[model samples]
Target: MKRVIARCLIMVVTLLLISGCNTIRGAGEDIERGGEAIQRSAGG
Candidate 1:
């Protein structure tokens, strides 16, 4: 029972970390795209 609880906790933490990383990565991509769009508009 103790082992099961430990495993669950580890799984939850891992998932949270993964999700946080993904969110940051997604935000970075959005910013990059916005910059590109602005550059294109300015160039044209």
Candidate 2:
């Protein structure tokens, strides 16, 4: 039915968004760490 298809589509989209958020958070943490390393090397 149309309702069933719509529900499935919503669920898939929700899962994709949740996964994307985690990916972005992980990338941010990595960049922060790299910046910290540079600061330490510079004695700042």
Candidate 3:
């Protein structure tokens, strides 16, 4: 019973970390795209 609980806790933490990483990457991409749009408008 103790082993099962430990395994579940580890799995939940791992999943949370993975999700956080994805969110950060997505935010970075959005910022980069916004900068490019600004430059394009200024140049044209």
Sort by lDDT, best first.
2, 3, 1
Residue 20 in candidate 1, Cα distance off native in Å: 0.2
Best by lDDT: 2
Please, what are the lDDT tens digits per residue for candidate 3 over residues 2-30?
Answer: 99999999999999867755887786887
Total residue pair clashes for candidate 1: 0
Off by over 4 Å in 3: 23-44
- Please give the CA lDDT of all the candidate structures: 0.85, 0.87, 0.85
| Candidate no. 3 TM-score | 0.50
Question: Whole-model lDDT, candidate 1?
Answer: 0.85
**RMSD for each of the candidates:** 9.8, 9.2, 9.8
Q: How would you encode candidate 2's per-residue C-alpha lDDT over 1-44 as one tens digit per residue? A: 99999999999999986775588778688779889999999999
Q: Which residue pairs in model 3 clash with each other?
A: none
| Candidate 1 structure quality by residue, lDDT tens digits, 8-27 | 99999999767755787786
| Model 2 / residue 1 / CA error / Å | 50
